[model samples]
Target chain A: MADARDAEIDDLINNLDRDYDFHPGGKDNAGYGRDQADNKQQDLQKLLNLWIAERTCPDILPYDEELISTLTDRLRAQVEFIEMTTTDPEAASQSKLKILLVESELERIKFLIRGYVRARMHKIDKYYLHLSTQDTDTKRKLSDAEQRFVLRRATQLKRFYDQRFLSSFPQALQRLDDNSPILPMVDTPDLNEFVFVRVLQDVPGEVVLSNDDSVDLQKGNIYVLPYKAIRKFLRVGEVELV
Target chain B: MALPLKQIGTFLPSEISFLAENTSVSIVPRQALDVLELIGLNLPAMRPMRRVEVPLWVAIILKKQSRCNIIAPTWLSEDSLKAAYEAEASNMTRFSNKLPWEWIEVGELVLTSAPDDLACPPHIIRNLLRDIREIRQAKVRAGLKSLDPTYMQIDNVGAMELNEIRQFVTMTMNELRVLQNGRAEEEAEEEVEQYPGEDSDLEDTLETTEYSIPRDSSNFDDSLRSRSRSAAPLGERRPTSRAPAYEDDEGDEEEDLEMDESYLHTVKDNSSGQR
Candidate 1:
């Protein structure tokens, strides 16, 4: 019975123009145009409902029913608009408006279908991997499952690496200055020069003045003392120059 | 009026004097001399105007230029120019054919710079002949049929053969170089004759840079050598299928054993020794 009805519908669709027109010549027949338009609308609604039922999962499945509904509603609205505009000659005068509405409705449907297909494919891949993991003991079974996992992971890592290294590194490196010092404290001399000078400490004073009492500085291994006494060294060119 | 001797070197004074003595003429200023020079006549030559008879055709062409009043007779004509061009071309073609073969080869080397562009450079030609003969002997020992007569003919001497193509190119380049060194009028004619058909082929193969054989040509050499090698061994393997079959149940168990037995049989038969 359903097949018979579908055949009938197909026949009507195939000869839609001939059945809907009044005559070959231009003439007005409001009743005939309304009936034909109503029949087309019914056929379109039936087709859209069948497509939605076949493609969309039930509420239990993780699928976007709201997006699907929105797309269907927009498509239904366009069908209604096309029917209304074509039935009345006066309303059909805005050809550009009709075209714009039809185009926008098609674009929306295309975007929704693309999104749905991408999401559905990703879900199917995940489901296949899960099922393959369960049969781990068989030799061929494990290898096939592992190969699938490797391919999926490789695709994911390739995308991540491209985004991280190839796209972002150039701009990040361009923002740095060459002269900016990385460690300023270690490079400054004031902190180290005073500490080196403090290292030369004298023992308890044995009146450590003696001849020409300038402060008697101890000679560390790095420092050397001349053979002349301190006061003689102070006198005008008296000590041997070393 | 004859040009003053002082102005002879500064302009086309000889042509001017001849035009002045021979025809009705006008003197164009130095500024219009450039325009006159472009039209293949020197302006400084025309002076002391008088009427002379030019052909109807020459007068009609000159009348359209708007620069000068048409003299009845003009010295230049389209037919005379075309005849001069053809005469010059014939002289160059005659000269090119008489050039020495060595000089032709040298000229070809300068043009193409490819060893294969000149009769395989004599040494390669000798080697190719020897190799083809050796390959033929091997084919006989292997009981293979002689190569097709057409291929042999092409190999010996044909247009597409390497050596023949080389000789053809050498001859062509020698002709071109001769044409290049000919008189200017001859050179112009030669350019028209040589460029239209031959230049496109030469441009495709003979790049201006030094020629080196493409690295991928090793594959061509490999294919040639392998084909020669395959032709020799094919005869020895033909009688192998005639061996008597022995039904042994154990033979089915080992594939490698069957291969080894057949290989040994082939070796023993070829080596003329008992297995």
Candidate 2:
């Protein structure tokens, strides 16, 4: 965190005397003015994308904490820097106005990030059971730290369930197979995996399921099939995933 | 099995499982039949006892006409289903694949649609299917309470059941998440209230966050008036924007007067007003 602040200070100190020749209005990626705005915009865009992914794909791991923390810290430092420059009597009036614009933009982005994280935290806490039981492919959506956290939480949950439900049940109701590890017991629902597909056009062709059973698709029928099975048809607009 | 899916005002898991059940049935024509036109396919003209594939609905129709007999799938039987049910019951901590994915739905479909074809009485088969459903529902309910990941197999579970449980699990999780974030119940309520008025495009850009600025008095008044207009024609057409700020005590009296004026205007406009 201290290193980040020092880097920002170094950037400001080194560039203070350098006259920028590039125009802000021109589509010049190399321009100092354009690059600063573009980088900030990109950061905001990435944050938005992370939030959207978290909401739409419940099975996928939630956004990493480090990303949010890093963004928050960067924005805070930028805000402080802008405040110092804006109030400085030596600072040029035009540059101060530009700094103010940048400050407002940063605040807007931070507001959005804060709201997005809050909303996602709600979902993460709510669907921990389903999320924890997710396969490696889905779990990989989370950061290393989040993955470890979920594993530990899942272990704690397994122990809690075993003590509360399994152990208390009669001997006959207990599991016959003892081979499989109890913690992180696999088989929870992948909430985002299925599609409520409506058969828009008649398909005389058969769909082979995971269990190798063949199903004949017909018009005006709705079925919740696995997304992978009908993704091709969805792409061609033959089926609508409602 | 986990507890039966709660009444989430959506399709039950059983109904989803029922819809998801394979509807295609293998049938054999008892006599030479011309079914090309009836079946909507270029199925070769069947000779006596020739096997033909058709949907369950088509099979039922053909059987009703005495043109063909339904060939029950290998999975449909009293003994096999009983064994499957037993396996599911015995294995409380693991998902059982002893029965086909749509066992309960398929059994009910066959028994209800073509009972006479079965070796046993329809009622007997119906009772057996009911028993299996009850046990399965009980299992689902238990799974919910225990958060039984093993018993809560979404793929093997029916759509109705999955959707029902999904709503509950998701809702519970969201509540916990909100609590962890230090949000109160009213904040959650306010968020939900804002959803319908929110733009779909903005929702995407905001990542489903309620980032749109909170409604101010003017916008709130406009919405309230619009809602009231749609709900009742007798409501006043007062210019809500011109109304004094709602915080003023006198503003309340002016609002009441407007309502009264509108009521009186309605009565005056109707010359032959009844009652």
Candidate 3:
């Protein structure tokens, strides 16, 4: 059910689990205990990442329905298990300390998730037009709900423009043709221009653009190519935008 | 002509994702003690050896004082990083979620701030990090070779590397999308060639103010033209209105042909209104 987005969410979850363990491993209680701890941590971060993803890209399809409930259940079980378990003073104190860290992290993650969502909603409401007609690739960033919202908004805008602005304008002033599909006017930031990229390696390669012009990419030197020319290199991480 | 499109910077997915990222760090205090009255701290007690999660700056301060040992995040480890690199390298078609949102920066931060606390030497970790980043980047290039821009997930990646990739990927995806829809190619290829020419243009345009226009907008050229045109007796209106039509016929030639239609529309609107 969870596809490409799965890997990133899982990565964050796994990190939270592995990074927060305070238990120093011994023979009897090494891998198994750590595994349980790791799962608990992973579960929490999974939720955090899900919230973050929703907030960051509200236009994408929503997350798997069962993911949150399953994680929350597992987390609850883990908390109960921790509470019931008994140990020596050192290990008991350590678990107590570990729990605090996990809870604090959870709080921090929630705060950030809240802030991110608020910021995105502000942008979405403010630039609903930009969000609506964003190229499909960019629109993929929106969650299903957001996608629906943008679609509705796009239709409303198309109608508003068709009835009000486009109807009033003469053929010379009108941009889209009469038969052309009505998409909300796209106000995309220009992406085909040169960007400040610092070459990260020494691999020298040649890039051919739409015009069949080749630009040489030499590592350790920064060269500004029409983004079209070096789009491939940028993705491969050979060049970093400064 | 397209209604004057807004050149909003925050609209970029990369920029928004960068802003949304959580770069906060957590550290375990080395020694616990009674709660001392600190100006910002709201905590009732400070226990030794307890994990006190703090912002990156606060973590830095505590680490500097040798008061806490930074819990090197899992993504910073050699084995996990290598695994992530392999995942990224093996699949050119997709960006793996093997690393955190700000994985590169987090790894760099931990290495720079708490080298001694890590399982391996800082230099070795640095080398490993470099290898991973390079491999993943190479994979991105390989993905681009397919010409199916759908495979690229710009959101999964972040930090400095994403900035360069974002511009290209966003443009490419946008171009391919418009091409499929049979729309006019608004994705104009500008004067990115002649690196020196681009730099000179930027320098010439940017000399007037300390504020630099973002490189990603066509507005840079618009602003540049407006600056030069500021001397001319066009209207006494704000400089933001599109440059006049007669000026288009005059010596101040436009840099790109794609913007010409919009400019002409502006002229038509201005002329018709004035009459």
Candidate 4:
């Protein structure tokens, strides 16, 4: 039931949105229905941004639970759609061509997911010690699965070190989280690491680099700054790491 | 095993090119094709001679099959490229913000895949892009000398250019931040003096991220987490129209079944003919 092909296909593919019930007042937005195309496009862009951010940011960002779950559901539907479309005998040549397009897009999204998750896993592996001992609120930033993985990884890595070399060291030396005055054993992301950020909105106030120097954060301008200096801006969506 | 040390925190040139392919370009399909119900976005039906927007990757596929002509983005036109080249060349101290973020990747892709579709000769566009890239790269190299520990403002830097300078700029700035911090610490100034921007907001955000860093072992060790208040907002909505219909997939499945039977009949005829 459709007035045009665009509307028809929009309904066909976007039924998953309704199934998820995430768009609580699905109809509240006057034309939220037809905007599926835009939503999907935006979601893709959001995923790309996340993948880039995860790769470049010094600290592990909060896990995007809602976005990932919605996308995972859509990926499943498309996979099923592909299975149905490829087997249909009508539009044999046409369907084959369409299948190619579908498959290509499917692979693109798959690549994005793999890149995003892999980057997160790599960070988790790097910072497990810090993550394991951090406050609960800090650990909650990771997905539940990641939380489990961090614990197991941190425990196993510590055990391995103990078996390999720590057993020979003094009791005090065996501790991984030794907050030594000079140097600590735990590895943490360098918050002071420099990152390139593309400003999304004008910063509320001038950013003070020090007592004397201040830089205006204008929209649509890219700046290279320590992740710590712009961390709040990145969170408030005033800027994004390029 | 760990990721390759060098590859860590870096993207290969080819990867950037691949990412660029997702951006849309205009195309006129020579042969009509049914709609593609893709996972990411639903592409509308393509009709002959009716120009439509499609992802660059799709345009490349259609162009390779001789089924469509890619409409090069206006910026890739000879006049635009020439203008951009001149603007960039004249601005020795700064990079003119003329090109798109994906300019380098998109320009190369279109030139290679559908050169015949461009308004001017491919070489002209290629040469212009090359000239612009050269001037901008030189500027990028020179800009490193002025890099401040606080921030490096280089507008209109191409994706590829950013990657090339990424390792060097990040390392140098990081070292500078540490040295500056050490000096600031010796002065016995509070940590708030070290960071710029809204102090309260910065502290609020730091509480959420729960950082693990600093000192670099030449020396580093500190925890800077606090009470959390706000979570960052999610993706915002864009303007779109129409009251959505609440149709179930039950109808689509029926339509699929009918098409299936009809297609099976055609398949039988073809198989019979072959036999």
Separate DockQ for every predicted complex:
0.00, 0.01, 0.03, 0.19
| TM score of chain A per candidate | 0.25, 0.48, 0.40, 0.84
Worst 10 residues of 4 chain A by lDDT: A178-187
> Candidate 1, which segments miss by more than 4 Å at Cα?
A1-61, A129-242, B1-275
> How do the residues B1-275 of candidate 2 rate in per-residue lDDT, one tens digit apiece?
01112321233454344333325677887766442311012233567787877556456656766767787666566776677678768966544555554565666667766778876677866776677667777877776675311112233454344555655654443333323222233332343343221123322422322233222323444444333222222211111111233223323233234434444454444322321
Candidate 3 - CAPRI tier? incorrect
Give the per-residue lDDT of model 4 (tens digit) for A143-171.
99999988998889889999999899767
Ranking by TM-score: 4, 3, 2, 1
Using TM-score as the measure, name the better of candidate 2 and candidate 4: 4
Residue pairs in clash, model 4: A208-B196, A208-B197, B215-B219, B215-B220
Worst lDDT window (10 residues) for model 1 chain B? B149-158
In candidate 1, position A201 carries an lDDT of 34
Q: List the residue pairs that clash in candidate 1.
A: B16-B45, B53-B72, B53-B73, B54-B72, B54-B73
Candidate that scores best on DockQ: 4
Fnat of candidates, each listed: 0.00, 0.00, 0.00, 0.47
Off by over 4 Å in 3: A1-242, B1-26, B33-46, B50-58, B79-98, B147-164, B183-275
Please give the lDDT score at residue B165 for candidate 2: 60
CA lDDT of A106 in candidate 3?
42
Decide which is better by lDDT, 3 or 4: 4
Q: TM-score of model 4, chain A?
A: 0.84
**After TM-score superposition, what is the CA distance of residue B38 in candidate 3 from its true location, in Å?**
14
Question: Cα lDDT for residue B231, model 4?
Answer: 5
Q: Give iRMSD, candidate 1.
A: 46.2
State the displacement of the C-alpha of residue B232, model 1, in Å, after optimal TM-score superposition: 54
Best by TM-score: 4
Ranking by DockQ: 4, 3, 2, 1
